[model samples]
Target: MDIRQYIDSTYLKTPAMAGTTIKENNEVVRSLVNEAVANGYKLVMVRPEMVAFVKRLLCVEKSKVLIGTVIDFPEGEGMLFKKLDEANKSIYDGADELDFVIDYKAFKRRDFEKVKTDVIECTRLCLDHKKIAKWIIEVAALSDKEIISITALVKNVVLTYFSESDYFNVFVKSSTGFYKTESGKPNGATIHSVKLMLENSFPLPVKAAGGIRNYEDAVQMIRLGVKRIGTSSASEIIAGEQVSDEY
Candidate 1:
């Protein structure tokens, strides 16, 4: 596999999040965008505010690197309208794909109705705009049964509301790369979690994000059927090396 094509070259940390100065953070985002464009990675994931800036960079270079931004990010508890507003703004800012963090907390609370509405609205927004949509179901926060249930929930939502032609554009993404967990447990994508997602969300591709720090792990995800990988370690992975930066 040409692993580069499967990468969602990512850097979602803000200045405060990374404890860096704003200039430093901008440089990091710029460098990541340039590197992704140079490497021809499938996409470059960034914060919603940076989507337009990244789009301008790609436009200047005439690059094909798709621009992806998160909606309602690490926390998916934003009111439905808030999430839609954020997604609409990002889409207007030239995002090619929007990875919306599903209201997993609601799902955990057994509010499947809320989860269904979240999926229906966000997924439809993306599909209507002819852009890729990914639903991030923060796996670290859920149990095995919850993971299975949530994945199936997304699959059913898309398959039920959207046409088959739209299936490929909708994805059940694994994490936001920003989920907090107790005791430093794996807070990002795990084989077990991703496996459940793939088994349940088949046909709608899965994008495994967060905590995937090495080439072996990236390839393993692909081998297990993930259509995309969102990671901060794309360069190291391309160089076939492992690094210890948790996304």
Candidate 2:
């Protein structure tokens, strides 16, 4: 299936958590970008600040691996303008795809309008800039019904505002890989959650993120019709190795 093409090799750790210095963290991102290019992975997902650095590195090396960054990150409680600002900067800094963490807090609170507006603005910004947009609904934090409703909500907004050709450009992604559950449960992509997302967001592409550790799991996601799989285990999966990392 040329799994490399559907994999987004990702590293979204903060500088402090990732390294002691900016140089050290950037070196990590650079290594990831280099590895992605060499391995023919589809993209390298990094923090927003690292987008420009990755872009410059790719330019110098003449690599075609896409640069993707997260917006609103693990927490989607930021104000709309702030999220948009982050998105704009990432795009200006050469991010080709933006994975936005939608305001699930608002959705859970039954503030559907707020949630819808948040998604619409961020997605429209990506559309205006001709960049890929994926909404990270943080499935692990929600119930089955919540997942279905939110996925459908995102689909409705995209179809309402965009053309058919642009549907694939917008995706309903599974998780942010950083959400904490009260029970300390696994807070990443699961087959059941992904199945719900796919069934609800049919025309819009679905990206299964988090908890996808091996090639077999990735292949299963593809079989479920996921367009992308986001994980730090991309290299391991591609090489047919199993790792114990949760990203």
Every candidate's lDDT: 0.90, 0.91
Model 2, 143-206: lDDT tens per residue?
Answer: 9999999999999998897889889999999998888777767688889999999999989999
Clashing pairs in 1: none
Per-model TM-score versus the true fold? 0.97, 0.97
What is the C-alpha local distance difference test score of candidate 1? Answer: 0.90
- Candidate 2 C-alpha error for residue 113, in Å: 0.7
lDDT of 2: 0.91
RMSD for each of the candidates: 1.0, 1.1
Off by over 4 Å in 1: none
Ten contiguous residues with the weakest lDDT in model 1 = 175-184
